[model samples]
Target: MNDPDRARPETPPGHRGVQYAGRALCWSLAGGMTTAAVDIVLAPGFHAWPVLWPLPWYLTCVSAVAWAVLRAREKAAALRLAADEDLVQGQDWERAA
Candidate 1:
């Protein structure tokens, strides 16, 4: 009964924070986009649309930035994990010698 993950190192606290932040950002952006869509659809006419026009653009930019940040954090965590695994394996080899 070999559990593969037993030897893996735990993720850093900051990694979890990044994940949580990304989730929050995604949900908030989704809510904003949904609200914006409803507002645009139910508006009286084009005359009153200017106020709600920039919501999509703003949300898009923010979403892009958040996506990039999350991706970067994920990559960093993966690299760290790989390094830790290598270190652990090296120690095991040394002990076997």
Candidate 2:
């Protein structure tokens, strides 16, 4: 999974924190606003079980955030690799044989 050769957008060195904050804000606003709207609409139907009304929508938002974080971490791991040691080893093996 930590393949350094993958193509991705290169973020500037010092702005990584800002970029992360922007992403978090976007996801938070989208999930919160959409879920709030849906909960309001469903409130009339599930008046008795108010807790269950927003459960599904909130769970979906959480799952989406989790998925995004998983992908970002995977990409970060790939980017952190200094070099592909295996490629050098493969070249050596080829030369020896």
Candidate 3:
């Protein structure tokens, strides 16, 4: 089996931007759940995330961001030519000089 942790080429920042936005959306959902649970059960003085107040809006935003990221990935994948086309010009990375 191949290791999935092999280094990826530097994708354009647009790809990264979409990915990070999706991550934030996930965090927002998690944080909101924690905050709401705390409010319903914990005492008043405990620290809580700001996620609860947005409620439905946060969920909607997260869903939208996820959809956008999926679309972007599809587009990028469609544009990629092939494995051999994305190679270093001179030599293989694992070979001796």
Candidate 4:
């Protein structure tokens, strides 16, 4: 039943609901903007918190994404660790004396 014509190209999904990277970036940017806006609204001080309106939001988004990505990676690693059984393979577990 081998059919060379039946081969399918594969594409993987990205993290969290955002599949496309560009789309994720755009959304992240919007989230960052919202964060900054909220901050400005909550604590109004143009002179003291001048940079909070623009930079923090973007940085916040970056940090949030980075954290989520890192967390995902960590979770994957932990799962892999649980499945690791190299010691049980190609060997015998006789009592060492």
Candidate number of the best lDDT: 1
For model 3, state the Cα shift of residue 53 in Å.
3.1
TM-score of each: 0.54, 0.36, 0.44, 0.38
Rank by lDDT, highest first. Answer: 1, 3, 2, 4
Lowest lDDT 10-residue stretch of candidate 3: 81-90
CA RMSD, predictions in order: 5.1, 9.5, 9.3, 10.8
List model 2 lDDT by residue over 1-97, tens digit each.
3336665445523345445545665666666666677767755564555675555556556656665665676566555543454665577689779
| Per-residue C-alpha lDDT of model 3 across residues 24-49, encoded as one tens digit per residue | 67777776677667667873553443
Task: Give the clash count for each candidate.
Answer: 0, 0, 0, 0
Score each candidate by Cα lDDT.
0.69, 0.58, 0.59, 0.55
For candidate 4, report its TM-score: 0.38
**Candidate 1 vs 3: which has more lDDT:** 1
Q: Local error of candidate 4 at 69, Å? A: 0.7
